[model samples]
Target: MSERKQRADATRNREAVLAAADALFARSESPRSVSMDEIAAAAGVGKGTLFRRFGDRTGLIQALYEARVQPLREAVESGPAPLGPSTPPLERVPALLDAMLRFKMDNRHLSMALEEAGSGSPYAAGHYTRWHSDLEEMLRQIPATATTAGFTAHALLAATRADLVEHLLGEQQMTPEQVRQGLAGHIARVLGDHGND
Candidate 1:
Protein backbone atom coordinates (compact mmCIF):
# COMPACT_ATOMS: atom_id res chain seq x y z
CA MET A 1 0.00 0.00 0.00
CA SER A 2 1.05 3.56 -0.66
CA GLU A 3 2.03 5.85 2.23
CA ARG A 4 -1.26 7.74 1.99
CA LYS A 5 -3.28 4.54 2.04
CA GLN A 6 -1.34 3.31 5.06
CA ARG A 7 -2.04 6.54 6.92
CA ALA A 8 -5.71 6.38 6.02
CA ASP A 9 -5.95 2.81 7.27
CA ALA A 10 -4.25 3.75 10.52
CA THR A 11 -6.64 6.63 11.03
CA ARG A 12 -9.65 4.43 10.35
CA ASN A 13 -8.38 1.79 12.73
CA ARG A 14 -7.82 4.34 15.48
CA GLU A 15 -11.29 5.74 15.10
CA ALA A 16 -12.76 2.30 15.05
CA VAL A 17 -10.99 1.36 18.24
CA LEU A 18 -12.16 4.52 19.98
CA ALA A 19 -15.75 3.96 18.91
CA ALA A 20 -15.72 0.35 20.00
CA ALA A 21 -14.22 1.24 23.36
CA ASP A 22 -16.79 3.98 23.83
CA ALA A 23 -19.64 1.57 23.25
CA LEU A 24 -18.15 -0.98 25.58
CA PHE A 25 -17.69 1.52 28.37
CA ALA A 26 -21.14 3.01 27.92
CA ARG A 27 -22.81 -0.32 28.45
CA SER A 28 -20.35 -1.75 30.89
CA GLU A 29 -21.33 -2.37 34.50
CA SER A 30 -17.82 -1.40 35.48
CA PRO A 31 -15.19 0.29 33.36
CA ARG A 32 -12.53 -2.03 34.76
CA SER A 33 -14.38 -5.02 33.40
CA VAL A 34 -13.90 -3.94 29.82
CA SER A 35 -10.60 -5.39 28.67
CA MET A 36 -8.29 -4.64 25.79
CA ASP A 37 -9.05 -7.97 24.17
CA GLU A 38 -12.74 -7.12 24.11
CA ILE A 39 -11.94 -3.74 22.61
CA ALA A 40 -9.73 -5.27 19.93
CA ALA A 41 -12.37 -7.83 19.00
CA ALA A 42 -15.09 -5.20 18.97
CA ALA A 43 -12.98 -2.98 16.74
CA GLY A 44 -12.10 -5.92 14.50
CA VAL A 45 -8.41 -5.16 14.88
CA GLY A 46 -5.59 -7.30 16.10
CA LYS A 47 -4.77 -7.11 19.80
CA GLY A 48 -1.23 -6.11 18.91
CA THR A 49 -2.59 -3.16 16.97
CA LEU A 50 -4.36 -1.83 20.06
CA PHE A 51 -1.20 -2.14 22.17
CA ARG A 52 0.95 -0.62 19.42
CA ARG A 53 -1.38 2.31 18.88
CA PHE A 54 -2.51 3.09 22.43
CA GLY A 55 0.32 1.76 24.62
CA ASP A 56 -2.09 0.24 27.17
CA ARG A 57 -5.65 0.28 28.50
CA THR A 58 -5.22 3.53 30.37
CA GLY A 59 -3.68 5.20 27.36
CA LEU A 60 -6.55 4.05 25.15
CA ILE A 61 -9.09 5.31 27.68
CA GLN A 62 -7.34 8.67 27.89
CA ALA A 63 -7.30 9.02 24.12
CA LEU A 64 -10.97 8.09 23.92
CA TYR A 65 -11.86 10.54 26.68
CA GLU A 66 -9.91 13.29 24.93
CA ALA A 67 -11.65 12.60 21.64
CA ARG A 68 -15.04 12.76 23.32
CA VAL A 69 -14.30 16.11 24.98
CA GLN A 70 -12.62 17.74 21.96
CA PRO A 71 -15.76 19.56 20.82
CA LEU A 72 -16.38 21.02 24.28
CA ARG A 73 -12.74 22.06 24.51
CA GLU A 74 -13.01 23.83 21.17
CA ALA A 75 -16.17 25.65 22.19
CA VAL A 76 -14.62 26.77 25.46
CA GLU A 77 -11.40 27.79 23.72
CA SER A 78 -12.88 29.73 20.78
CA GLY A 79 -16.63 29.53 20.31
CA PRO A 80 -19.22 32.20 21.18
CA ALA A 81 -20.51 33.63 24.45
CA PRO A 82 -20.72 31.81 27.79
CA LEU A 83 -18.07 29.25 26.90
CA GLY A 84 -15.71 31.25 24.73
CA PRO A 85 -12.78 33.32 26.03
CA SER A 86 -14.62 36.47 24.96
CA THR A 87 -17.44 36.05 27.48
CA PRO A 88 -17.56 38.01 30.71
CA PRO A 89 -16.18 36.14 33.71
CA LEU A 90 -19.45 36.32 35.63
CA GLU A 91 -21.32 34.63 32.82
CA ARG A 92 -18.47 32.38 31.79
CA VAL A 93 -17.93 30.80 35.20
CA PRO A 94 -21.43 29.39 35.48
CA ALA A 95 -21.47 28.47 31.81
CA LEU A 96 -18.21 26.59 32.15
CA LEU A 97 -19.43 24.70 35.22
CA ASP A 98 -22.71 23.83 33.56
CA ALA A 99 -21.00 22.63 30.41
CA MET A 100 -18.65 20.47 32.42
CA LEU A 101 -21.47 19.02 34.49
CA ARG A 102 -23.38 18.15 31.37
CA PHE A 103 -20.29 16.56 29.88
CA LYS A 104 -19.78 14.36 32.94
CA MET A 105 -23.44 13.41 32.95
CA ASP A 106 -23.37 12.52 29.28
CA ASN A 107 -20.14 10.59 29.41
CA ARG A 108 -20.31 9.15 32.88
CA HIS A 109 -18.80 5.82 31.98
CA LEU A 110 -15.95 7.18 29.97
CA SER A 111 -15.31 9.92 32.49
CA MET A 112 -15.29 7.41 35.29
CA ALA A 113 -12.89 5.22 33.39
CA LEU A 114 -10.50 8.05 32.79
CA GLU A 115 -10.72 9.28 36.35
CA GLU A 116 -10.15 5.84 37.77
CA ALA A 117 -7.31 5.07 35.43
CA GLY A 118 -3.82 4.48 36.92
CA SER A 119 -2.91 4.85 40.59
CA GLY A 120 -2.69 8.63 40.58
CA SER A 121 -5.39 10.97 41.78
CA PRO A 122 -7.84 12.22 39.16
CA TYR A 123 -6.83 15.77 40.08
CA ALA A 124 -3.42 15.02 38.58
CA ALA A 125 -4.86 14.18 35.16
CA GLY A 126 -3.94 16.48 32.30
CA HIS A 127 -7.58 17.19 31.45
CA TYR A 128 -8.34 18.08 35.06
CA THR A 129 -5.40 20.48 35.19
CA ARG A 130 -6.47 22.20 31.99
CA TRP A 131 -10.04 22.59 33.20
CA HIS A 132 -8.96 23.79 36.63
CA SER A 133 -6.62 26.34 35.06
CA ASP A 134 -9.31 27.66 32.75
CA LEU A 135 -11.80 27.90 35.57
CA GLU A 136 -9.32 29.51 37.93
CA GLU A 137 -8.44 32.16 35.37
CA MET A 138 -12.10 32.99 34.85
CA LEU A 139 -12.75 33.01 38.58
CA ARG A 140 -9.87 35.42 39.09
CA GLN A 141 -11.61 37.90 36.81
CA ILE A 142 -14.61 38.02 39.16
CA PRO A 143 -13.88 40.20 42.17
CA ALA A 144 -15.98 38.03 44.47
CA THR A 145 -13.95 34.93 43.67
CA ALA A 146 -10.61 36.46 42.78
CA THR A 147 -9.14 35.94 46.24
CA THR A 148 -10.02 32.28 46.37
CA ALA A 149 -9.94 31.42 42.70
CA GLY A 150 -7.74 28.37 42.94
CA PHE A 151 -9.66 26.72 45.78
CA THR A 152 -12.98 27.85 44.31
CA ALA A 153 -12.15 26.34 40.96
CA HIS A 154 -11.32 23.04 42.59
CA ALA A 155 -14.46 23.09 44.73
CA LEU A 156 -16.64 23.92 41.76
CA LEU A 157 -15.06 21.17 39.69
CA ALA A 158 -15.68 18.73 42.53
CA ALA A 159 -19.38 19.38 42.12
CA THR A 160 -19.10 18.10 38.56
CA ARG A 161 -16.92 15.10 39.26
CA ALA A 162 -17.86 11.87 37.49
CA ASP A 163 -18.62 9.93 40.68
CA LEU A 164 -20.78 12.74 42.03
CA VAL A 165 -22.63 12.99 38.75
CA GLU A 166 -23.22 9.24 38.72
CA HIS A 167 -24.49 9.33 42.28
CA LEU A 168 -26.95 12.13 41.57
CA LEU A 169 -28.19 10.56 38.39
CA GLY A 170 -28.17 6.94 39.46
CA GLU A 171 -28.70 6.83 43.21
CA GLN A 172 -30.50 10.08 43.94
CA GLN A 173 -32.41 9.93 40.66
CA MET A 174 -31.93 13.63 39.99
CA THR A 175 -32.82 14.69 36.48
CA PRO A 176 -30.19 16.38 34.36
CA GLU A 177 -32.24 19.56 34.52
CA GLN A 178 -32.34 19.38 38.32
CA VAL A 179 -28.59 18.93 38.56
CA ARG A 180 -28.11 21.89 36.20
CA GLN A 181 -30.50 24.09 38.17
CA GLY A 182 -28.77 23.19 41.41
CA LEU A 183 -25.40 24.07 39.93
CA ALA A 184 -26.76 27.34 38.56
CA GLY A 185 -28.11 28.28 41.96
CA HIS A 186 -24.80 27.41 43.58
CA ILE A 187 -22.92 29.56 41.07
CA ALA A 188 -25.38 32.41 41.45
CA ARG A 189 -24.79 32.41 45.17
CA VAL A 190 -21.07 32.47 44.57
CA LEU A 191 -21.14 35.23 41.94
CA GLY A 192 -24.23 37.21 43.03
CA ASP A 193 -26.13 39.35 40.52
CA HIS A 194 -23.39 41.83 39.67
CA GLY A 195 -25.32 42.94 36.56
CA ASN A 196 -24.85 39.44 35.18
CA ASP A 197 -27.12 36.52 35.91
Candidate 2:
Protein backbone atom coordinates (compact mmCIF):
# COMPACT_ATOMS: atom_id res chain seq x y z
CA MET A 1 0.00 0.00 0.00
CA SER A 2 2.85 2.40 0.78
CA GLU A 3 4.52 1.57 -2.53
CA ARG A 4 1.26 2.12 -4.36
CA LYS A 5 0.86 5.53 -2.73
CA GLN A 6 4.43 6.42 -3.60
CA ARG A 7 3.90 5.41 -7.20
CA ALA A 8 0.78 7.54 -7.42
CA ASP A 9 2.59 10.51 -5.97
CA ALA A 10 5.41 10.10 -8.43
CA THR A 11 2.95 9.89 -11.28
CA ARG A 12 1.30 13.11 -10.18
CA ASN A 13 4.67 14.83 -9.91
CA ARG A 14 5.68 13.68 -13.38
CA GLU A 15 2.43 14.97 -14.83
CA ALA A 16 2.95 18.33 -13.17
CA VAL A 17 6.47 18.54 -14.55
CA LEU A 18 5.24 17.76 -18.03
CA ALA A 19 2.49 20.39 -17.76
CA ALA A 20 4.95 23.06 -16.72
CA ALA A 21 7.32 22.01 -19.46
CA ASP A 22 4.55 22.24 -22.01
CA ALA A 23 3.61 25.74 -20.91
CA LEU A 24 7.24 26.83 -20.86
CA PHE A 25 7.90 25.35 -24.27
CA ALA A 26 4.96 27.32 -25.61
CA ARG A 27 6.03 30.57 -23.97
CA SER A 28 9.82 30.47 -24.26
CA GLU A 29 11.71 31.34 -27.42
CA SER A 30 14.55 29.08 -26.42
CA PRO A 31 14.64 25.92 -24.32
CA ARG A 32 17.70 27.32 -22.56
CA SER A 33 15.63 30.14 -21.06
CA VAL A 34 13.34 27.65 -19.36
CA SER A 35 15.14 26.45 -16.30
CA MET A 36 14.90 23.35 -14.15
CA ASP A 37 14.09 25.49 -11.13
CA GLU A 38 11.12 27.03 -12.87
CA ILE A 39 9.84 23.64 -13.96
CA ALA A 40 10.25 22.34 -10.39
CA ALA A 41 8.39 25.32 -8.97
CA ALA A 42 5.62 24.93 -11.51
CA ALA A 43 5.39 21.23 -10.84
CA GLY A 44 5.20 21.75 -7.07
CA VAL A 45 8.32 19.73 -6.53
CA GLY A 46 11.77 20.47 -5.20
CA LYS A 47 14.56 21.30 -7.64
CA GLY A 48 16.34 18.18 -6.45
CA THR A 49 13.36 16.10 -7.45
CA LEU A 50 13.36 17.52 -10.95
CA PHE A 51 17.05 16.78 -11.37
CA ARG A 52 16.65 13.25 -10.11
CA ARG A 53 13.71 12.58 -12.36
CA PHE A 54 14.95 14.12 -15.61
CA GLY A 55 18.74 13.93 -15.19
CA ASP A 56 19.15 17.34 -16.82
CA ARG A 57 17.41 20.24 -18.52
CA THR A 58 17.83 18.84 -22.01
CA GLY A 59 16.37 15.54 -20.98
CA LEU A 60 13.32 17.27 -19.57
CA ILE A 61 12.97 19.41 -22.67
CA GLN A 62 13.28 16.38 -24.89
CA ALA A 63 10.67 14.51 -22.89
CA LEU A 64 8.37 17.51 -22.96
CA TYR A 65 8.81 17.72 -26.73
CA GLU A 66 8.05 14.06 -27.15
CA ALA A 67 5.00 14.31 -24.95
CA ARG A 68 3.67 17.39 -26.68
CA VAL A 69 4.75 17.34 -30.34
CA GLN A 70 5.06 13.69 -31.26
CA PRO A 71 1.30 13.34 -31.26
CA LEU A 72 0.97 16.20 -33.74
CA ARG A 73 3.46 14.43 -36.01
CA GLU A 74 1.62 11.13 -35.77
CA ALA A 75 -1.71 12.81 -36.46
CA VAL A 76 -0.32 14.42 -39.58
CA GLU A 77 0.94 11.10 -40.85
CA SER A 78 -1.83 8.72 -39.77
CA GLY A 79 -4.72 10.58 -38.14
CA PRO A 80 -7.17 11.63 -40.89
CA ALA A 81 -8.20 13.72 -43.84
CA PRO A 82 -6.08 16.17 -45.66
CA LEU A 83 -3.30 14.65 -43.57
CA GLY A 84 -4.36 11.02 -43.43
CA PRO A 85 -6.11 10.15 -46.67
CA SER A 86 -9.38 10.76 -48.49
CA THR A 87 -7.53 13.35 -50.59
CA PRO A 88 -5.25 13.03 -53.59
CA PRO A 89 -1.51 13.66 -53.27
CA LEU A 90 -1.77 16.97 -55.18
CA GLU A 91 -4.45 18.38 -52.89
CA ARG A 92 -2.79 16.91 -49.82
CA VAL A 93 0.60 18.28 -50.78
CA PRO A 94 -0.40 21.87 -50.12
CA ALA A 95 -2.89 21.06 -47.39
CA LEU A 96 -0.29 19.17 -45.35
CA LEU A 97 2.21 21.97 -45.83
CA ASP A 98 -0.36 24.55 -44.76
CA ALA A 99 -1.42 22.58 -41.71
CA MET A 100 2.17 22.01 -40.55
CA LEU A 101 3.00 25.66 -41.13
CA ARG A 102 -0.04 26.73 -39.14
CA PHE A 103 0.89 24.43 -36.30
CA LYS A 104 4.41 25.84 -36.18
CA MET A 105 3.18 29.43 -36.39
CA ASP A 106 0.78 28.79 -33.55
CA ASN A 107 3.41 27.06 -31.43
CA ARG A 108 6.45 29.23 -31.91
CA HIS A 109 8.50 28.20 -28.90
CA LEU A 110 8.31 24.53 -29.72
CA SER A 111 8.83 25.54 -33.32
CA MET A 112 11.97 27.43 -32.44
CA ALA A 113 13.33 24.46 -30.55
CA LEU A 114 12.66 22.04 -33.38
CA GLU A 115 14.00 24.51 -35.94
CA GLU A 116 17.18 24.81 -33.92
CA ALA A 117 17.51 21.05 -33.76
CA GLY A 118 16.80 20.57 -37.50
CA SER A 119 18.34 17.34 -38.73
CA GLY A 120 20.50 17.03 -35.64
CA SER A 121 17.79 15.63 -33.41
CA PRO A 122 16.75 12.08 -34.16
CA TYR A 123 13.09 12.72 -33.37
CA ALA A 124 13.06 15.82 -35.54
CA ALA A 125 14.70 13.94 -38.41
CA GLY A 126 12.20 11.11 -38.07
CA HIS A 127 9.26 13.49 -38.40
CA TYR A 128 10.75 15.23 -41.43
CA THR A 129 11.54 11.92 -43.08
CA ARG A 130 7.91 10.89 -42.68
CA TRP A 131 6.72 14.14 -44.20
CA HIS A 132 9.25 13.88 -47.03
CA SER A 133 8.26 10.30 -47.80
CA ASP A 134 4.58 11.13 -47.72
CA LEU A 135 5.11 14.12 -49.99
CA GLU A 136 7.22 12.05 -52.33
CA GLU A 137 4.49 9.48 -52.62
CA MET A 138 2.04 12.24 -53.52
CA LEU A 139 4.51 13.92 -55.84
CA ARG A 140 4.69 10.61 -57.67
CA GLN A 141 1.17 11.26 -58.94
CA ILE A 142 1.94 14.63 -60.54
CA PRO A 143 4.08 14.93 -63.67
CA ALA A 144 6.41 17.56 -62.20
CA THR A 145 6.76 15.48 -59.08
CA ALA A 146 6.27 12.35 -61.19
CA THR A 147 9.80 11.63 -62.34
CA THR A 148 11.24 12.06 -58.87
CA ALA A 149 8.96 12.44 -55.91
CA GLY A 150 12.08 12.96 -53.83
CA PHE A 151 12.92 16.17 -55.69
CA THR A 152 9.37 17.42 -55.38
CA ALA A 153 9.42 16.53 -51.71
CA HIS A 154 12.50 18.71 -51.23
CA ALA A 155 10.76 21.55 -53.07
CA LEU A 156 7.76 21.26 -50.77
CA LEU A 157 10.14 21.57 -47.80
CA ALA A 158 11.54 24.78 -49.27
CA ALA A 159 8.07 26.21 -49.80
CA THR A 160 6.59 25.37 -46.39
CA ARG A 161 9.23 25.83 -43.69
CA ALA A 162 8.16 28.26 -40.91
CA ASP A 163 11.42 30.19 -40.92
CA LEU A 164 10.83 31.05 -44.56
CA VAL A 165 7.25 32.16 -43.89
CA GLU A 166 8.34 34.22 -40.88
CA HIS A 167 11.00 35.82 -43.05
CA LEU A 168 8.51 36.64 -45.78
CA LEU A 169 5.93 38.02 -43.33
CA GLY A 170 7.86 39.48 -40.41
CA GLU A 171 10.93 40.81 -42.20
CA GLN A 172 9.63 41.53 -45.68
CA GLN A 173 6.20 42.45 -44.32
CA MET A 174 4.45 40.55 -47.06
CA THR A 175 0.72 40.42 -46.64
CA PRO A 176 -1.03 37.13 -46.02
CA GLU A 177 -2.37 37.24 -49.56
CA GLN A 178 1.11 37.69 -50.98
CA VAL A 179 2.39 34.75 -48.97
CA ARG A 180 -0.50 32.57 -50.15
CA GLN A 181 0.05 33.53 -53.76
CA GLY A 182 3.74 32.85 -53.47
CA LEU A 183 3.18 29.41 -52.02
CA ALA A 184 0.61 28.57 -54.64
CA GLY A 185 2.80 29.84 -57.44
CA HIS A 186 5.69 27.76 -56.17
CA ILE A 187 3.60 24.62 -56.05
CA ALA A 188 2.06 25.32 -59.43
CA ARG A 189 5.37 25.97 -61.13
CA VAL A 190 6.85 22.84 -59.67
CA LEU A 191 3.89 20.67 -60.51
CA GLY A 192 2.59 22.41 -63.66
CA ASP A 193 5.95 22.26 -65.40
CA HIS A 194 6.31 18.53 -64.96
CA GLY A 195 2.78 17.82 -63.86
CA ASN A 196 1.31 14.78 -65.69
CA ASP A 197 -2.23 15.63 -64.60
Candidate 3:
Protein backbone atom coordinates (compact mmCIF):
# COMPACT_ATOMS: atom_id res chain seq x y z
CA MET A 1 0.00 0.00 0.00
CA SER A 2 1.06 3.57 -0.64
CA GLU A 3 1.94 5.92 2.22
CA ARG A 4 -1.42 7.73 1.83
CA LYS A 5 -3.25 4.41 1.92
CA GLN A 6 -1.39 3.47 5.09
CA ARG A 7 -2.44 6.78 6.71
CA ALA A 8 -6.03 6.26 5.64
CA ASP A 9 -6.04 2.76 7.15
CA ALA A 10 -4.72 4.15 10.43
CA THR A 11 -7.42 6.82 10.49
CA ARG A 12 -10.08 4.22 9.91
CA ASN A 13 -8.63 2.06 12.64
CA ARG A 14 -8.76 4.92 15.16
CA GLU A 15 -12.35 5.80 14.27
CA ALA A 16 -13.43 2.20 14.61
CA VAL A 17 -11.87 1.93 18.04
CA LEU A 18 -13.58 5.10 19.23
CA ALA A 19 -16.94 3.95 17.90
CA ALA A 20 -16.59 0.61 19.66
CA ALA A 21 -15.57 2.28 22.89
CA ASP A 22 -18.52 4.65 22.70
CA ALA A 23 -20.99 1.78 22.34
CA LEU A 24 -19.50 -0.34 25.11
CA PHE A 25 -19.04 2.60 27.44
CA ALA A 26 -22.53 3.83 26.71
CA ARG A 27 -23.91 0.54 27.96
CA SER A 28 -21.68 0.44 31.03
CA GLU A 29 -19.24 2.98 32.41
CA SER A 30 -16.94 0.25 33.69
CA PRO A 31 -13.64 0.85 31.98
CA ARG A 32 -12.56 -2.58 33.11
CA SER A 33 -15.37 -4.18 31.16
CA VAL A 34 -13.61 -3.05 28.01
CA SER A 35 -10.04 -3.70 27.02
CA MET A 36 -7.71 -2.62 24.23
CA ASP A 37 -7.86 -6.15 22.88
CA GLU A 38 -11.65 -6.16 22.73
CA ILE A 39 -11.67 -2.74 21.16
CA ALA A 40 -9.11 -3.85 18.58
CA ALA A 41 -11.12 -6.96 17.79
CA ALA A 42 -14.24 -4.90 17.37
CA ALA A 43 -12.44 -2.40 15.20
CA GLY A 44 -10.75 -5.06 13.09
CA VAL A 45 -7.40 -3.58 14.08
CA GLY A 46 -4.63 -4.93 16.22
CA LYS A 47 -4.52 -4.25 19.97
CA GLY A 48 -1.31 -2.34 19.43
CA THR A 49 -3.11 0.03 17.05
CA LEU A 50 -5.82 0.74 19.60
CA PHE A 51 -3.20 1.51 22.25
CA ARG A 52 -1.24 3.69 19.85
CA ARG A 53 -4.28 5.79 19.11
CA PHE A 54 -5.76 6.05 22.62
CA GLY A 55 -2.87 5.56 25.08
CA ASP A 56 -5.22 3.92 27.66
CA ARG A 57 -8.77 3.56 28.94
CA THR A 58 -8.85 7.15 30.09
CA GLY A 59 -7.93 8.46 26.68
CA LEU A 60 -10.60 6.24 25.13
CA ILE A 61 -13.18 7.54 27.58
CA GLN A 62 -12.25 11.13 26.86
CA ALA A 63 -12.59 10.59 23.10
CA LEU A 64 -15.92 8.80 23.46
CA TYR A 65 -17.35 11.61 25.59
CA GLU A 66 -16.09 14.23 23.21
CA ALA A 67 -17.59 12.40 20.26
CA ARG A 68 -20.90 12.07 22.05
CA VAL A 69 -21.12 15.68 23.20
CA GLN A 70 -19.70 17.43 20.17
CA PRO A 71 -22.84 16.79 18.16
CA LEU A 72 -24.98 17.95 21.08
CA ARG A 73 -23.01 21.18 21.29
CA GLU A 74 -23.30 21.67 17.58
CA ALA A 75 -27.02 20.98 17.75
CA VAL A 76 -27.36 23.68 20.36
CA GLU A 77 -25.14 26.05 18.43
CA SER A 78 -26.64 25.54 14.95
CA GLY A 79 -29.20 22.77 14.49
CA PRO A 80 -32.78 24.05 14.81
CA ALA A 81 -34.89 27.14 15.41
CA PRO A 82 -34.72 27.29 19.21
CA LEU A 83 -31.67 25.17 19.75
CA GLY A 84 -29.85 26.27 16.73
CA PRO A 85 -29.29 30.04 16.61
CA SER A 86 -32.70 31.04 15.32
CA THR A 87 -34.76 31.73 18.44
CA PRO A 88 -34.47 34.56 20.96
CA PRO A 89 -32.17 33.92 23.88
CA LEU A 90 -35.00 34.03 26.42
CA GLU A 91 -37.05 31.54 24.48
CA ARG A 92 -34.03 29.32 24.20
CA VAL A 93 -33.71 28.75 27.95
CA PRO A 94 -36.71 26.50 28.49
CA ALA A 95 -36.14 24.94 25.11
CA LEU A 96 -32.55 24.29 26.01
CA LEU A 97 -33.57 22.61 29.25
CA ASP A 98 -36.13 20.54 27.45
CA ALA A 99 -33.59 19.42 24.92
CA MET A 100 -31.13 18.68 27.69
CA LEU A 101 -33.67 16.62 29.57
CA ARG A 102 -34.52 14.65 26.47
CA PHE A 103 -30.85 13.92 25.96
CA LYS A 104 -30.50 12.73 29.54
CA MET A 105 -33.51 10.48 29.16
CA ASP A 106 -32.19 9.02 25.95
CA ASN A 107 -28.78 8.22 27.37
CA ARG A 108 -29.82 7.64 30.95
CA HIS A 109 -27.15 5.24 32.12
CA LEU A 110 -24.30 6.98 30.38
CA SER A 111 -25.62 10.27 31.63
CA MET A 112 -25.89 8.87 35.14
CA ALA A 113 -22.37 7.51 35.07
CA LEU A 114 -20.99 10.67 33.55
CA GLU A 115 -22.71 12.75 36.21
CA GLU A 116 -21.46 10.52 38.99
CA ALA A 117 -17.96 10.51 37.60
CA GLY A 118 -17.88 14.31 38.03
CA SER A 119 -14.51 15.92 37.43
CA GLY A 120 -12.69 12.77 38.42
CA SER A 121 -12.42 11.83 34.76
CA PRO A 122 -12.27 14.09 31.74
CA TYR A 123 -15.20 12.29 30.17
CA ALA A 124 -17.36 13.25 33.12
CA ALA A 125 -15.61 16.50 33.96
CA GLY A 126 -16.30 18.17 30.62
CA HIS A 127 -20.08 17.79 30.87
CA TYR A 128 -20.18 19.12 34.44
CA THR A 129 -17.96 22.09 33.69
CA ARG A 130 -19.69 22.81 30.41
CA TRP A 131 -23.04 23.09 32.16
CA HIS A 132 -21.80 25.97 34.27
CA SER A 133 -20.22 27.67 31.31
CA ASP A 134 -23.31 27.01 29.22
CA LEU A 135 -25.53 28.50 31.88
CA GLU A 136 -23.29 31.53 32.20
CA GLU A 137 -23.31 32.10 28.47
CA MET A 138 -27.08 31.89 28.28
CA LEU A 139 -27.49 34.31 31.18
CA ARG A 140 -25.10 36.71 29.50
CA GLN A 141 -27.01 36.52 26.25
CA ILE A 142 -30.27 37.16 28.14
CA PRO A 143 -28.41 39.77 30.17
CA ALA A 144 -29.46 38.22 33.46
CA THR A 145 -27.22 38.20 36.53
CA ALA A 146 -26.17 35.75 39.18
CA THR A 147 -27.20 38.18 41.93
CA THR A 148 -30.24 40.13 40.71
CA ALA A 149 -31.75 37.29 38.73
CA GLY A 150 -33.17 35.77 41.94
CA PHE A 151 -31.03 32.70 41.28
CA THR A 152 -27.81 31.98 39.59
CA ALA A 153 -27.92 30.07 36.30
CA HIS A 154 -25.90 27.43 38.05
CA ALA A 155 -28.54 27.21 40.76
CA LEU A 156 -31.29 26.79 38.21
CA LEU A 157 -29.41 23.95 36.50
CA ALA A 158 -28.71 22.24 39.79
CA ALA A 159 -32.42 22.37 40.52
CA THR A 160 -33.15 21.03 37.05
CA ARG A 161 -30.78 18.09 37.31
CA ALA A 162 -32.06 14.78 35.93
CA ASP A 163 -32.50 13.35 39.42
CA LEU A 164 -34.59 16.32 40.50
CA VAL A 165 -36.47 16.29 37.23
CA GLU A 166 -37.22 12.58 37.55
CA HIS A 167 -38.37 13.17 41.09
CA LEU A 168 -40.81 15.74 39.82
CA LEU A 169 -41.99 14.19 36.58
CA GLY A 170 -41.66 10.49 37.26
CA GLU A 171 -42.07 9.95 40.99
CA GLN A 172 -44.41 12.89 41.59
CA GLN A 173 -46.44 12.12 38.46
CA MET A 174 -46.11 15.61 37.07
CA THR A 175 -46.45 15.93 33.32
CA PRO A 176 -43.43 16.97 31.28
CA GLU A 177 -45.24 20.11 30.23
CA GLN A 178 -46.08 20.92 33.81
CA VAL A 179 -42.48 20.62 34.85
CA ARG A 180 -41.49 22.84 31.96
CA GLN A 181 -44.05 25.43 32.95
CA GLY A 182 -42.87 25.29 36.53
CA LEU A 183 -39.33 25.82 35.45
CA ALA A 184 -40.46 28.69 33.28
CA GLY A 185 -42.23 30.27 36.22
CA HIS A 186 -39.12 29.94 38.32
CA ILE A 187 -37.05 31.56 35.60
CA ALA A 188 -39.60 34.30 35.11
CA ARG A 189 -39.59 35.12 38.78
CA VAL A 190 -35.84 35.23 38.74
CA LEU A 191 -35.76 37.54 35.76
CA GLY A 192 -38.52 39.68 37.23
CA ASP A 193 -36.42 40.27 40.29
CA HIS A 194 -34.32 42.82 38.45
CA GLY A 195 -37.26 44.75 37.05
CA ASN A 196 -38.48 47.95 38.75
CA ASP A 197 -42.03 48.24 40.01
Among the numbered candidates, top TM-score falls to 1
Measured by C-alpha RMSD in angstroms, how accurate is candidate 3? Answer: 4.5
Across residues 1-197, which tens digit of lDDT does each residue of candidate 2 receive?
69999999988998899888778767775655777788899888999989888887766755665676676667666777767766777778777777766665565566555555523654246556777887788778765567778876887786766667767777899876677777777777767766544
> TM-score of every model?
0.95, 0.73, 0.66
Query: How many pairs collide in each candidate, listed in order?
Result: 0, 4, 0
Residue 46 displacement in candidate 3 (angstroms): 3.4
| Alpha carbon lDDT of each predicted model | 0.92, 0.72, 0.66
What lDDT tens digits, residue by residue, belong to model 3 across residues 1-197? 99999999888877888777667756654545666677778778887777788786666665666667687788777788677777776777667766776666555444554554424643246566676566567766665463433246666666567566657766799877787778778877765664332
lDDT value, residue 100 of candidate 3: 73
lDDT, model 3, position 11: 82
Residue 87, model 3: Cα distance from true site in angstroms: 2.4
For candidate 2, report its TM-score.
Answer: 0.73
